[model samples]
Target: MSAKVPASPRFAYKGDRLKPLRAFCQTARLGSISRAAEALFLSQPAVTLQLQALEREFGARLLERSGRRISLTREGQELYELARPLVEGLDGLDGAFRERVRGLDAGELNVAAGSSTILYLLPKIVEAFRATHPEVRLTLHNVTGAGGLDLLRSDAVDLAVGSMLDVPADLSYEPVYRFEPMLITPRNHPLAQKAELELQDLSPYGLILPPQRLTTYRLVDLVFQQNRVPYTVALEVGGWEVIKQYVAMGLGISIVTSICLTEADRERLATRSLARYFPSRSYGVVVRKGKYLSPHARAFTELIRPALFEREDYYANGQSER
Candidate 1:
């Protein structure tokens, strides 16, 4: 019997066993193994293996895959409901505690913003912030409108800076900058010759629009609908740069934020400020409702709006930062 002592298991997971659940939760929240890996600073294979471990431990498939998209299964949803808050709380605990114990000298700040804002808006502000606080790590997520808001909900990002046409109930938007809208056309276009362009003037010409689901298309739809104007769509493209290129090639004219009109863009196309036709779009910071802000987040946000962090005694009041 003394010779029959049981051998220890060949494999072992020593550190926090909850890690598999944490990786699984981030995968569920972001719906992509690659993205979850990026968020966790782990290899994609590591995240995939952790997910496999979770599914094997529970004896169920936790995820479902479409053509290119991954979604949570019913079992996955149930687990996520219980696991998301735990993972967020555990990961956020360090930043929250450190900021309270010390100050803005340390901590991490992650931000999400749309492509237009990343390309045209954030360079200088981010440079200024980094110059002031090189110790604080800053990451800017270049995501689309819908994707950025989704990242905000999962606590993957501390703050999101972009334009919002429709604000969700669970999110708060604070406008910081207003930019005029401009119509872009080839210099030879008949409409481009007009000193003043009207809604009716656009009816006959082909219009290049962003995809229908995006807010850009929605705003264009609203303006045309209000004026009872009928328009033709020549093409539906994704980025402002591509749209500009097509317009330059004489595909069709497109409306864009004036903030994107660089001198280089100006030489290729003519622009007329359409402020009279469309209200200036606002770009601002958005945060989750009832969320806590780390000192790093507060310091960076205060840079965006001096009044934003001034009123909130984040430690004492803890009143909603929204």
Candidate 2:
């Protein structure tokens, strides 16, 4: 009698290799096998076995474990970087295929933006998008910059719309709008009376600024420090509307992006361009480096700015500054 062939090892065949790779990618991303297992709905031992299988298949040690922390080795890092996009693409294939079949007539598009952007910048564009693609389910997530970035990275949102002071390596920012910085004070305040104002002139008046952790506060701090101008904060609060209200009440003067300014605001508060002191803020679309845009997403982005991703070198530069 012929000897029977031994059963093949699990995930040993080329076609079946995706299983191990998926496990490894998830583990690397979470930095913990247990968390990866939880995300993948697999047992910890199973995930560990899959990782081992992947390492063996590639003939390289792919992970280094210390206490509760797990990190990728040099070879693992290189492999993870190369394989992540492929894995992500594969993982999203079903949804992408469905979106393609549905076309722009139907599909969900999630966009993340801050309150100011939702209030001022996106109103017209959003209205236009809804008019064109009323059937598409569009969800707008109002979140801060850091929160928006987190959502973008986690694939919770298809794109983010807002101002970015610094661009990360794994993300691309393409600016579509620019607004000058402005200093606002009560209409009758001393600074508002002058046709021209100096930075030092405002030092005596207390400033109403956002929280210290926000970009606006930091930018204002940086400018004053560089110019050696001493300043004080009269109030720390959130939201441009609240700040403007406080300034109008003569609590203190404030610096704000012109994006939030309106004709009505001018009647209550005297506004002067602070472009010389602060850089103009640019608002745009931010996306993960290798994110695949769906038909609904593409349609919405096009409404914001035509051909937003036509160029292949779009991500080559961190951002296009105007």
**lDDT for position 148 in model 1:** 91
Clashing pairs in 1: none
How far residue 259's Cα lies from its native spot in candidate 1, in Å, is 2.0
TM-score of each: 0.62, 0.65
State the lDDT of candidate 2 residue by residue for 1-322, as single tens digits: 9999999565544567777788889999899999999999999998898888788778899999978889999999999999999899999999998876775456778999999989877787888888888887889999997899999999999999999989999999988866777888888888877766789998999999999989999999999999999999999999999999999999999998877876578578877777778888888899999999887787777777642222223211221111
* RMSD versus native structure for model 2: 13.1
Mark the regions of model 1 whose C-alpha exceeds 4 Å error after superposition: 1-105, 305-322
| lDDT for position 116 in model 1 | 85
State each model's CA lDDT, in order: 0.80, 0.84
Off by over 4 Å in 2: 1-105, 305-322
Backbone clash pairs in model 1 (N, Cα, C under 3 Å; residues 3+ apart or in different chains), count: 0
Question: Model 2 misses residue 6 by how many Å?
Answer: 9.7
